[model samples]
Target: MFMRKSKFRHVFGQGLKRDQCYDNIRITKSSWDSRYCDVNPKYVAVITEAAGGGSFLVLPLSKVGRVERDCPLVAGHKAAVLDIAWCPHNDDVIASASEDCTIKIWQIPEGGLTKPLTEPVVDLVAHQRRVSCVKWHPTAHNVLLSAGSDNKIYIWNVGTGEVFTEIDLPDLPLSASFNFNGSKFACTCKDKKLRVYNSRSGECLQEGPGHAGAKPAQVAYLKDGLIFSTGFSRMSERQYALWDEKDLSKAKEMNELDNSNGVIFPLYDADVNMVYLCGKGDSQIRYFEVTDEEPYVHYLNTYQSKESGRGVGFMPKRGLNVNNCEIARIYKLHNSGLCEVIPFTVPRKSELFQDDLYPDTPSDTPALSAEEWFGGKDADPIMVSLKGGFVPTRKDALKVVRRSNVLDKMPTRTSQAQSTNSEAAAAPSLPPKPSTTSTPPDEHVGFDPQGILDDMRKLKLIVKAHERRIKTLEEKLSQYEVNTSEEDEGKA
Candidate 1:
């Protein structure tokens, strides 16, 4: 028998025990094709069903147990929440888009939600139709892109509450993604075409035929100017393909995965060059190794389970268990109101850190600001070492500084033939002002001194907790070294 000699060939999936999972959650019943859940190192947020408006539950990763019926929620939108994404540079920050034709940015507290969060840090109301998707820039601070049913995409600077760029599409976008450095953008549209564009300039770069099916399609930008997409064929058979950005007239490699009707969600790990495909309402996760060779995508193995998942949230690499050789962790949401934690680990007997399985992954640091990115600048993500285990740095609360209303001061248009050039020139020069229009008189204005003091107190407590955990880990590592030395001496 011949076997592949790869470090991840023996990878296995393990589901946590029932007590370790979150139960009694009222997941949303929206028909929207979204993950419905998002996770980070600090918290895991799940879109839940609400009566009057849209709401989602944000729980600390340590609070794994049966949730109460009246748990606190982040409720604000007037409609169902379609998508949610956590900021890559700040674990405490998250963005949510909804059918209310707006997007909201929230900042979760350190100890988790004690009361219902009705107010968002920033309220963006630009889309005329319901917003479908929201994504944060990979390496930029406070930069966000949102897609709406109006056949439009707007890139916003959350810190400033301003639209940095507006891109109009011919059809609705099924999915959108940014390249590794956040310089290029790609999306699959309802017109059955995959379109690539300059993210900043909103210029269409290329367009080609996407999947042949009528169902929704997804696109993910990979390393080295590559793109991966998943959709159905004309016969409704599930299929996947890899494409080169330079030439999208045809896919570099294409293959049919299966005949399942569930939508396949692709999650890519750039460090290991592996992509995991998880189908909605399916009990299996198929993974593949991507390369630059002839067959670009090579199928590995599949992780099968008895229970199917309605949505899945992937944990960042920095949150994995390095001591246990764990490479990936996914939080799968079930129809039975249960959220299960599944860990994928590579088989290894050694107790030491495995550098090959874990490379220098992206850190929680912004490589560019919103102004710089909108000014046509691009930079790679900042990488951090995980040798001694990753310790998250404390970050201050995000501040939103909006410009004054220039529309109120502009002269009224006398005729329809008035040049629009004057209006565009006046927008940028408006003096900056604290956005207190949305807040009540009693509420704290832009930089709240009391809020800062509270945040500092919470950060101090968090630092103390991390220090204690690190000390315990150090002691265990020392004991393991001593035991290994004794065993070696006895063998000699």
Candidate 2:
């Protein structure tokens, strides 16, 4: 009987439901450091610190079964690799720039050491100082750009593995970027200037002011040929500025940002014309959208993790098929002293990209069909019904009523005139006699004297209240004037 009772309980009892994938598998800081993952047609190559302290490792973004099949694609830099670039046109090609003052280009499947790219195809050692930035050409597939502490920018061609053109800058270059079409490129340097160049001719097309203090950490291009720059001020303020491509002599400063913890990781999302300022003492990512006026920025949300660090790479537009896709992979240097990746999906989708008919939450769940939303065999409409019905009925209704009252209560000539007369004498204005401007009625207009009288009474009360306020203000002003005169005479 005890066994039978247990069996019945097991068969009929209900408990907690299984956790959804979105909630259960949060991208936590792992042992691996994936600072930047660039996706190609066939593979995703991530740039990470191999054992910390200047060493770098590259891994392909593929899995054999459940575990990732990672092979060190490149090695041999004496110092920490500052940055890496992939050949925009070739899937198996990549390049790395390091603090060792060298830039190496490698083919993925090249032979030599046991691991692929345990060797490099060609090495370019031209920079006198540490290389900080590397980027591929917008249109020229094999061409790349590298900037370093030497305050120089080198344009290189991978085919020849040589410097194609060398350009000099005013200060130590921090970040650089290419425009959408490849016609122009821009760079931010320690000198506090953003310079735009003509990629084909290597000519300085334009340059703009970015406050000079600590050089800009990042620069990016926005739509309509606009640009953004982020850096720190001498006063310990974090600064962000926007510029127009045509005339770079001046820029519109977004706002004087208070540095949260003296560290700012600024990133620009061109797909949505948004620039994100991340990091500091707080673990929140702040977002700013570009506009003709001043750029508007707001804190998106905060991540609660001491393991989380400042290194985050936003997935470019080509990566995912959704709007305001903010699941930017973030990392921090921790634990065994390795980088960890945290994937964050924005809680709400931008209103700009939402459907005109109805906006919804950002859900990883596969969207249900119309039949499912209405009534389907597998779906329980009650769940959706309850979720959708969560809208605050009472508060929303009051808001609508308040807005309607604003337009409904605007002072009209008839109401204003009725308000001037005493309540007993003032009568509601008679409906205007049929005028030529009036639409001809099927029959003569019928007047409602009682309705008119009630409206006139209400109008008189409102106007009288306004008149009382005006009279009070005038009396105060007269008293102020009398006091001023007396004070002046006493002084004389």
Candidate 3:
């Protein structure tokens, strides 16, 4: 039997033992369409159901065992968290969108959560309705994109807490993905249309019909200007399609898989050009090799399991075990409150580094800044070699400088007085100049008394503003105290 001579043909999935898996977790039961989980080399975050608010649990990758019943949670959102994404440049930074109609960015400590994390570093409040999705830019630092049920898409500069760009869609976007360079993105919407748009300008360059079925669909932008999507057919059968960026009016290749009701998620690895299709509530993961050849998409293999998965998260390439010939790792969330670790490895007899299977992959360093990406500048992702294994660089703290009103920037009266005193003291005593030739008003050498008066007026206004702000804060504090007392009384 002559098989397709490919490096990934012998790839097999190996599941870790029960002791190595994370157990006793309370995964969310929200009907929202999301992975509900995100994994990095350092930690794994899973959304859990909370009583009065939404929360997620962050666990260290090394702490693989039964989770404690009273584990600390990242509970900042007043409503259920719909989606979450980890920043590519910083492992400790994450963004979460919630049904509270807001998106919050959180920073975890190096050792994971020691107590309940109730505060977020940045809170973005622009969506008029519940936010459904959040995605970090692939190659830019401090850049994030979010979609809301209000039919609006916002690109944010997380560092400065300002919207870099905005895109209005005809309908709610079901799924969205950024291209290699962060220059463009493709989206699948509830209107059953696939559209590609400019990331900065928000111009729709291409639009076409998507899957005919009414269920949710997912889209992923590939390396060589290709798009992969998965959705249900008109007959309710699950199907996947490949499309050329130049033409979306028709799929380059479309194939039907099964009649499962769960939505299929297509995860693409640009290094190997392989796409893994994992469906919610399905026990198997089907992967395919995408090429520019006749068939375009080739079926590689499937990894089967007995327990069904509620959600799944794929780890980055740099986290794989190169010595064990591991190419990819997936963290599968089971309905039984267990997170299983599955590693996909290519069988090989060579004891040396296999160059064929491992190429230069995307490094953690970002190639562009949010300002550059929003200013019409584009660059591909920075790549690094994995021959000697991966070592992460030290990341600085994520500082969020929010936008403020003009009054907030005004100098205080005490500082202004200090500046005036300093200026007067630094003046060289000229022994009273003898009131020399009558100096023209335009060429006056002395400080303007009128200007001092203006400064005094401005300082008074600043003082009034500060007093108003203090009074407001005092009122809020009193109200909060009253509410707390009432709540205590009710509990008693």
Candidate 4:
């Protein structure tokens, strides 16, 4: 286990791996998914969806050194696979959730997925709706959580084909996850609420409203039982909030200034207490270090994705005190269906910079009381916008290019006869310093058909949102109609 000592960790280089899959006979739009399966702290597994519809691919963090292409894993899913997770107890096994409304479990070979999956050992079908998210229990090998359109969270025991419990939430559940200790889990639903539940008892222990008037897309647990959620705000701003699980009345802190234009992807790095936040606003990944004390957010840095539209995952860091904070890497589903594994060497020490670079003074922590924290006329939240959209941390960006060999892969410019090209004519000038409403990495490249499939993903999100709203509104409407009918009968 790598020892984690302090905050001033150095940035490391990322490894590159790619596979241009063209085996499927039926050609349709290309789609991509990404996940980091840590079979061990030293070996992180990365899985990707091949272009069009075929089989899923897997790559190990160790094999990155040999420059071998990613190979397909167990390929039983007849449709595009959506989510993949590694079992906690047995590292060799993995579970996949697909659009086919089924969750398939497979045992990975020691040599890796270089060979075909003759068959999936287990196929569970408990979800009545599309299984959008699938996660393994932190401690239990066969325990899993799958949430989807059914407005419910299902706790399934992979050892048997039975669901241990079902959480029939009032709204559509968006994202769910188990904490490191496995004592509790947190989930976000379409009602803009963050609910923490006991995994064993299957009971809601605590619940809090998040992203007022807007459905929350993702929620994550931080150190000291603090939870973070990202979703839309009533004003359309991408809202990110930090809440204390024990006290759900109000968020310890709330940041609603993300201008990702509705792109709602989020991932948390529990090791360094960092949040790897990415989505519609920029083509890069932004890092925010979570502190243990008040005002728990420290803007760390950002890294641009090599391929246009890719999903991202932070490799699980067991206990490494390396210079670079990141232990493993995964891409966000982006324009290019290409996925790469980034292998980095941690540095000794490093400093952080940000737009609202708060001085490392005592006043950094909020002096406000709990009453002030909630249930009052709150102070205006601080809005910090990095001048050029997602500002890339130079070291991190260079590391990505160096390890990924991105520059070498770019089309070479063969300038043969142009001799008198003016200095002004050359290097056309950077696009008008993008305004505050800067296009997110995903949106910037969203136009590239190869980068993002049909924007069908956006449609799915919107449809889900509408479905939740209708569900809520109809329930209220039915109650009101009943009350009015009762009054009419009394008058008669």
Candidate 5:
């Protein structure tokens, strides 16, 4: 017998709000770095330059949409802003990397910026070439890092403007991410190699061959100290490889996927140990779960759409729904607009609490000084609590996924059809009893190809008719409900 499935099942939910996609938000098409905030999910920052040099515009997100009237615009970078990273420790502060070869830190007031924030809190001017990516320290607060074309990565204190470590390399770095404990970082370089460096000592911990193509690669750390990288092969096929961060002697698993024209960017969810692979020109985000076993990468499902994305942004775990077991939320950027994709757990309605949804998510804690981080101690990230949580539920929180669609839920239709065909073809010779009772005309008893098609078409038409009637009734009911609610309010 098949083993029982887990109580919590993860799947995509309806996009939260209407009028979701925002158009003409200034975003750099070339840079792969995230231009939105992951720490504070309430606001999102983007580079918007309709008339001239791009300025940083912060939009306060509401359940309905972004509040455009009170949006704040910070103008400081002389050139187009390539990347923006919000400080995980402080929600009011953010940093921007620009093509001016300088990184600027801007502070957003609590009530939202009334006027343009033309001045920056601090500026670090050291990179020789254009800056590409800026990432805040995961565990250590106030510490930020920036990589530029000057073939150097600089880690500095965002508040003091002090350089803690400058990693000089021979090649330009593409992407960089701190490990789980912030002891080390794995970065991708222009030479098609992944190099993991010690955070405090700036020593190379490991190096190995990645996707082996000319295009830039992206890397991220996994739950079991394994690091995964995505890049293209010599044949121009997109692929990803997983390796142990400590031992780069061999890759744990290397898998090639559908050959596409865009580079695959991996978005990891530490809460669920699932990695979502999204490509530049693709309309679907493919995800897989990594386990501690052979064939570690288990194929999940794909979320598809009609339009493709120029860029995608992932929200932090703390912002996700702890009650519903939300794995991740992706913001897909199209040429005209932006769309949010949310993945939620499909738990049984009878379940009391989903234990899997609430992992120790990467969260912010008290800021640590530079001395504390360099002291060679493990710093743990704060996690959102699961047991005795804030959100209250009345037994059944989320709706149940009912298997009401007969055709959609049926799994043995094909096998049954094949068996019927085989039996009809290889049947024993019929006895003379078939001639009894005036020998009724031999009707076509086997599966008729046209008959099945006709039946399916009829069923589809009937479903559509029923759907139309239901929609009409729902609209009328909604109108009546609104009227009744207004009357009740008046009575009250």
Candidate 6:
């Protein structure tokens, strides 16, 4: 009764009640699997792998602080379902990979799966080891990638159930992710190498010594052909690094952090140019701002909690409430219930902030089928209305952090990141900067059309030069084969 509520002025720090959690729910493991989804926006998916691995539960949050659990259990994997992803092109359809060494794609018939959906529409089996992870291509339809402990990454076309290609890695892959355009991807491997792949040709675009230590690392792509990774140092301390995709030998920035045994999972927000690093078994999330300049990983604040998080889920960009100036929302899985954590950025409670930040987000209905996605087309997400279109105003929306002990569970904000010069800041990692910056205004604002066109031309030339190099290498290898054949005949 002594703690005052006025201090928590902006952050929405509410915890899910007992009923909000899926009854008798538990997660599989948090080592490399982040098993939570808001792909449907209206409904979120969480793996019930703790039930010994056959199914998952989809909970719809159409109503505030309430979850719909009547949805059917998606079952088919003979073994524990390790990972599942909602197709970006088709909201209802989902893809899952299992320890059974197979991948299955299921469609969420309207009103959710009513029966014990026994079979998936498409089943793919090729991985020799347990498929640990699966990721859908950001801009491509029906294109999916799977990573296995067998040290292989497979790209597949779910529609045809055919393997598009496979990339063999030097070590076992811990995780994999695609860039914004789906033309490239980055994966963190157990051997401590971060490998970037060309999605179009399945070529190893770049491989570099990633994290400084022997443990597994996490990698995420940033804007403008840059990548950032989180891992441990040689001395078993937590450290993260940023690198230019073009040059693997030199790093743009690398910093050692307080050593924690838990592995840090890197999640990137492309719209805001920020990356949130969540550690395994840790309650709070450490986020950083990624700019095109130096010291790219500028530490933001941490959303601390009393309960150590077991697993976490990130809501898709389009599913968020822009009217609240919401940047990103995270659902953390705890032993008892799921907590919805939303980190926002609003400058003062005024109509000006609303008009400036609350622009219409992409909500057009997506292609209904994988066939439509294969057409190489893009569509907006149909704008979803929450609470029957009654938008919550700024003060009305800021939720109070609810815990058994509200005062103790309140998040402690700090700044411990470095400045833009690659030097750690005097004290806090990241402090609040101006809401507006020197960033260029877009055409939606004041973009330079000529400058953009010039940049495209330069990129086109680079692609052509790369093609020429590949052709020359192929020709040289062919000639070498001819010479070796003649030498063998002479010897005979």
Per-residue lDDT of model 3, residues 180-245, tens digit only: 887889999999899999888889999988899999999999988999999989999999999888
RMSD of 5: 29.6
- In the range 1-492, model 4's lDDT, one tens digit per residue, is 943434434444454544432121121133322232233432344344445443555555445423234444557776667677765334455777776677777766655676778455445665666766788755433457887677777776554334566778888777887775555788887787788997666789998877764644677777578888777778777767888889887988887756556455667755446676766425666566688755677665566655543344454433222233334354344344333445443443444332122212111111222112222223221222322222211212211221111111111121111112333222111112233576555565435642132243234434544675588799999999999999999999
lDDT of 4: 0.53
Tens digits of per-residue lDDT, candidate 5, 242-347, equal: 8888777678888888778787778887777878888887888888778787777777678887778777667776666655656567777665545454454554
Least accurate 10 contiguous residues by lDDT in model 6: 406-415
As for candidate 2, its clashing pairs are: 54-80, 309-332
lDDT of each: 0.82, 0.50, 0.82, 0.53, 0.66, 0.62
Task: Tell me each candidate's TM-score.
Answer: 0.81, 0.55, 0.81, 0.60, 0.73, 0.69
- Residue range 32-108, candidate 1, lDDT tens digits: 88999999988999999999899999999999999999999999899999999998888877899999988988878
RMSD in angstroms between candidate 3 and the native structure over all alpha carbons = 15.9
The CA-based lDDT of model 5 is what? 0.66
lDDT per residue as tens, model 6, 1-492: 642222123334344454554444545543554544334555567776445456776655543354445446788788877788876645566788788777777766655655767656556666768888889876544678999877888887664455667777888888888876667888888888888887656789887888768877878887688888888999999988998888877789999877788778787776556677777778788777776655556665677778787666776666666655665677776766554544455445643334433334333232222333343444323333332222322221112321111111111210111012122111111112213476444546555453454344334434543575588699999999999999999999
Candidate 4: minimum summed lDDT over ten consecutive residues — where?
402-411
For model 2, residues 95-194, the per-residue Cα lDDT tens digits are: 7777778786665542212363544444555677888778875443345788888788887644334455678788877778887655578887767777
lDDT of 6 at 221: 80
Q: TM-score order of candidates, best first?
A: 1, 3, 5, 6, 4, 2
Global Cα RMSD, each model: 20.8, 29.7, 15.9, 22.1, 29.6, 18.6
Give the lDDT of residue 452 in candidate 5.
Answer: 54
| Superior by lDDT: candidate 3 or candidate 6 | 3
- The alpha-carbon deviation from the true structure for residue 314 of candidate 4, after best TM-score superposition, in angstroms, is 2.2
